[model samples]
Target: DARVTQTPRHKVTEMGQEVTMRCQPILGHNTVFWYRQTMMQGLELLAYFRNRAPLDDSGMPKDRFSAEMPDATLATLKIQPSEPRDSAVYFCASGTRGNTEAFFGQGTRLTVV
Candidate 1:
């Protein structure tokens, strides 16, 4: 059962509220990934960090979306003033350094009014 850990498996927030999602990458893993799944856009990679440093997050709304890794094991994604359009299943995955196989965690399903 080696996998990433995500908290608050589901969340319902009012529009304009802030939401934060958390993940604990597998121990010793140096790469973490975040993704979002939606009806229209399908599945898209939002951002990723290697060695706990963000490579790029252009796919996300720069003003509203943020991703960070406070340490090797923990990664976080936050949405400020959340909107209904932001409702989606957010997934967190991790892999060993330079490894291609990623282990995914049970996603956090977010709903905004």
Candidate 2:
């Protein structure tokens, strides 16, 4: 079945630690997105990619957070020196280039203590 698969479904880390999350998008999908969900912000789009090229990442903190699509099927999001404020559910989604319907992964819940 075609699905978006995310790894490390839950994570707990101390402040100043590094966190890495991975996602495998469904085959044939050309667009991918990284999102962070918080009670206050709701679902915020952190990064966007089409055909494995990053089109926007302005919502992400450039100093500490990064999103990349290393290959056609692999996407990654990393946070360095994570702070408690970064705690949230990170989601990976994929869809076709011209489609509005996106398939979301289960998400990776992160807690920085």
RMSD (Å) of each candidate, 1 decimal: 0.9, 0.7
What is the Cα-based TM-score of model 1? 0.96
| Winning candidate number (TM-score) | 2
Against the true structure, candidate 2 reaches a TM-score of 0.97
Model 2 alpha-carbon miss at residue 85, Å: 0.5
Put down candidate 2 lDDT per residue, 1-113, tens digits, no spaces. 88899999999999999999999999999999999999999999999999999999999999999988889989999999899999999999999977989999999999999
For candidate 1, write residues 26-51 as lDDT tens digits.
Answer: 99889999999989998899998999
* Alpha-carbon local distance difference test for all models: 0.93, 0.96
Q: Give TM per candidate.
A: 0.96, 0.97
Count clashes in each candidate, considering only residues at least 3 apart in sequence or on different chains. 0, 0
Clashing residue pairs in candidate 1 (N, C-alpha, C atoms within 3 angstroms): none
Number of the top-ranking candidate, with lDDT as the measure = 2
